[model samples]
Target chain A: GAGVSQTPSNKVTEKGKYVELRCDPISGHTALYWYRQSLGQGPEFLIYFQGTGAADDSGLPNDRFFAVRPEGSVSTLKIQRTERGDSAVYLCASSSGLGRNEQFFGPGTRLTVL
Target chain B: AQTVTQSQPEMSVQEAETVTLSCTYDTSESDYYLFWYKQPPSRQMILVIRQEAYKQQNATENRFSVNFQKAAKSFSLKISDSQLGDAAMYFCAYRFNQGGKLIFGQGTELSVKP
Candidate 1:
């Protein structure tokens, strides 16, 4: 079975540029999550979608960050006016559902804002 | 606030030896899940093991086992006969029963010596 996957394994952008990172969840997965990992730190939750609706977006750092899962299988994380502080690895994960289900993660997209 | 903490920033073990990584969590909720995830340089988070808060017995998989102390709010992972492939960044995470978002710790980097 295929696991979750993220596109453009690496992205480099200018401080004022915009970038979009995509994630393809596992088949039959109902829950998708996004997390950000800064250098030398653990991953911090960003947002999660249950089906097509975002169940939570509290982890998003600010208004510049947004995400959507239109068909419930693929998700895109968008960042506006990227900053140097936005440089980090963005990881995506999916699970069967909430509760005790384990999350399967993607290989993460490293975003570097110059 | 729910938070997970991994005190060890780095751990090293010789091949065929045992190494234990410590994790502690603080949360008001009683029902939740704990997880250990591994991330190598490739930057993919892989589920190593999971333990449900409602279960009293510890969880084990192959050479990996967790000493889960509910009363102490501690979960430690012990890897027996550590191999070089086991080397990676280990993270402890907590997730409430209601949501799919995960709260992760600061991760511990483990290295294996041949």
Candidate 2:
């Protein structure tokens, strides 16, 4: 019954610092995804995991961004040398990996690189 | 390879009225999924409705429904009896049948007035 959940509802950090955003998927969900949404823009896919392994990560913009999902439930998005351009809402979603299962999203974590 | 487009940046409607938001997508794949998601100020993405490409009939959820045109690559969301609570940014998204990353459109901000 619990929807996906993300930690640190808001995070403000200085440029060049490192930051980590965490996500907890819904119970029994086997698929997880991460997305980044800039101001006035639609959310862009960053990574997807169909268990503990990432199935597709082509959407990751650059080397500065990385994500990992271990044990197939929890995921963490880590940014190194954060930039002002990285300021945006980081969203997480999960689904059952079944046919046509709708993804349930978490309240995204807004990250601001000051 | 897949892209979603939302033409309306903002729309307003009186409570109890109906409003439609238009979306179009470009994709070579025939089997895919289309969805409408709502994001409130709280930054949570919620599924509004979904339409499977193979389904000839449109998808509906209560007052929310979608007009999905496969040949034209057009998908539009129609909200009936729009409530003040429906005020939010609406996004059109697309994904392939087997779990993959989502392609989202620039959102439409909807406002409902009493």
**Pick by TM-score: which candidate is best?**
1
Q: What is the DockQ of each candidate?
A: 0.93, 0.79
lDDT of prediction 1 = 0.95
lDDT of 1 at B13: 99
lDDT of 2 by residue, B14-112 (tens): 999999999999999888999999999988888899899999999999999999989999999999999999999999999988757889999999999
Provide the lDDT at A82 for model 2.
99
Candidate 2: which stretches are off by over 4 Å?
none
lDDT of 1 by residue, A33-75 (tens): 9999999999999999999999999999999999999999999
Q: What is the interface RMSD of candidate 2, in Å?
A: 1.3
Q: What share of the true interface contacts does each candidate keep?
A: 0.98, 0.84
Ten residues in a row with the worst lDDT in model 2 chain B?
B94-103
Question: lDDT tens digits, residues A1-114, model 2?
Answer: 478899899999999999999999999999999999999999999999999999999989999999998788899999999999999999999998845898899999999999
Best by DockQ: 1
- Colliding pairs, model 2: none
Assess candidate 2 and give its TM-score to the true structure: 0.97
